[model samples]
Target: AATEAALKDVGPIDLLVNNAACTKLQPFLEVTADQFDLLFNVNVKAVLHVSQMVAGGMKTRGSGGSIVNVSSQASQRALRDHTVYCSTKGALDMLTKVMALELGPHQIRVNSVNPTVVMTKMGRLGWSDPEKAQTMKSRIPLGRFAEEEDVVNSILFLLSEKSSMINGVALPVDGGHLAC
Candidate 1:
């Protein structure tokens, strides 16, 4: 695969960001087996595979590395019509914790960022309904959804030396959504 080939060419990877994800918003009863499989394959399996590859290289190099998985607030909060997506993210959060525990001895830190509804193009369309947006915003103490920069900054901090001692943390950039 292209990713494997690139890793091979570059040799040991010092930092890895597993950000690949996919989702389908549908009622739990309406989610088909195939839909579940696709979401799991992309969101969960891909992160496992990529992290294994890079972490192996990092271990071989005998140098510590940082891995940040971009998860979602849905992992912690139950959202309607997002059963499979929420499950995938929840699995990812657990994976981050386990990876951190196992890799800590090797000095490889693993963490995740749980961001609330970000105002990206997809987010704009997803929350286009003012009623829905307001309803969701009311729960956030910040009185707003997350910005792309907010998520990026959190991720960068987790990946940088600044978070060298931090591991197994699911940092939330959710404007206090988790508090509610």
Candidate 2:
């Protein structure tokens, strides 16, 4: 019902960002089914549900819009203790591409932003140890983690007309981490 009610009596939603996610740092052997379900519900399923509803509106309104799904670098690489987390993002990335393929004709662009690590509070938890942090940073040619603005700017670019031709791509904002 919330999805149905979104932007009702307000206006058409020209832009949508599906960024909700949850993660538990546990190895696959130690991860519980409940934890797996929770992450999938929020990260993968929620994005699908919300996007379907919003895109339905956008499709009917006949105006092209942009939808950005915030993914993670773990989607492409296996990170220790991130089995469920990585799986969720991997699923999300593919979902973004499929949505793009179907929505492109309607001028609705769908994309995913896969970032290395933004210095958010939660992001700092695992990498708080200098040695551990440096280990990851060293892999990135830029030798750093992403800032909030770095991600925000990328999303903004994807949403704007500047990226009108861009669609169905998982743009990595990984400071070259993925490249290395």
Candidate 3:
């Protein structure tokens, strides 16, 4: 209902960013049924729901739009204590591909930005332990994690006409972590 109300007021939406995400750091064996459901509900289901709603509008408008789902590097590689979170993102990446394939006829491009751990205040606080931070950073060729701007800039590029031909790509904003 809230989504419908927002769409009604926004007119035709030419851009949609399904940045839905939720995570609880737990080992795979310890992740409870309730936790898995919560993560999937927020991370995967919400994206599907929103994309369907927005794509319907784009198709109706007869003008192609772009959708950028904010995925994570964890989607491409397994990370410790992120079993369920990684699963959610992996599903999101595949969802982006299928959405692109189906929506291409309408010129609606769908892509994702898979960012490394971004250094927001929460990120910094969470990774404040030097030993843990270094362990993660050492894996990246750039020897660092991404800044918030790094991830934001990638999203902007994908959404802009500059990347008009790019679709169904899971562009990594990780500092070469995945490359390594």
For candidate 2, the per-residue lDDT at 177 reads 85
**lDDT string, candidate 2, 1-180, tens digits:** 765676465578899988787788898789999999999999999999989988988999999899999999999989989999999999999999999999999999999999997898768886798988888899999989999899999999999999999999999999988886
Angstrom error of the Cα, residue 110, model 1: value is 0.2
Candidate 2 yields a Cα-based lDDT of 0.92
The regions of model 3 sitting more than 4 angstroms off are: none
1-180, model 3: which lDDT tens digit per residue? 787777777778899888767788899889999999999999999899889989999999899999999999999999888899899999999999999999999999999999888887656766788998999999999998898889888999999999999999999999898997
Q: Estimate each model's TM-score.
A: 0.95, 0.95, 0.95
Please give the RMSD of candidate 2 to the true structure: 1.3
The positional error of residue 69 in candidate 3, measured at the CA in angstroms, is 0.5
Any runs in candidate 1 off by more than 4 Å, and if so which?
A: none
Give the distance in Å from residue 27's predicted Cα in candidate 3 to where it truly belongs. 0.7
